[model samples]
Target: MAKIWAKAPSPCIGVCKFRDEGRCLGCQMTKPEKKRFKRLKGKAERRPFFLMLRERLEARDRWNYWSRMYRRRCLKKGADCPLDKLEGAEREARAA
Candidate 1:
């Protein structure tokens, strides 16, 4: 089940350089993925996109830096971060 949000913020952290092949060094989203995110309307779509983006960041070992910046962005936008909830759930799953 995807976590619903009143408003999900973009995963981009303004570091738009495509330094890692086609992925952004900041959010690990490609240009098309970024555009796709902007086109998504509801929480169902956005949340999954965020999760996928997080996975991409993790694959690149960039989640640490990107998560911090993304959390700040969510704070500034008054939006709930998908990473927070997802990470907590992951920890609980591991514990049990």
Candidate 2:
């Protein structure tokens, strides 16, 4: 029997404009990464991608914004957010 897999949700925030640096102004994903993201399957495949995206967002100083949006998206989907494991600061910020 084939193993069932759960797909990781997209990190897009609906702001698709590309910056001059060739990254998305919203999600911070590069055009090529965004295209490849659509073709990726399963959490196993997407985990590393999201980790890299988080690093990119951190480099661009957009980690907090992305974390909040990601949490909201997880809530909306009634899914457990993997981000919670990596973003304790986001929870504390919200509590404040």
User: In lDDT terms, how accurate is model 2?
Assistant: 0.74
Model 2 error, position 57 (Å) = 0.6
Cα lDDT of model 1 by residue, 1-96, tens digit? 343443667789999999898888888888999888878877667767777877888898998998899889988987777777778878999999
For residue 64, model 1's alpha carbon misses the true position, in angstroms, by: 0.6
lDDT of 2 by residue, 23-92 (tens): 8888998888888988877657666687788999999899999888877877787767767544564578
**For all candidates, what are the clash counts?**
0, 0
What RMSD does model 2 have? Answer: 6.1
What are the runs in model 1 whose C-alpha is more than 4 Å off? 1-6
- Candidate 1 has its poorest 10 consecutive residues by lDDT at 1-10
Best by TM-score: 1
Tell me the whole-model lDDT of each prediction, alpha carbons only.
0.80, 0.74
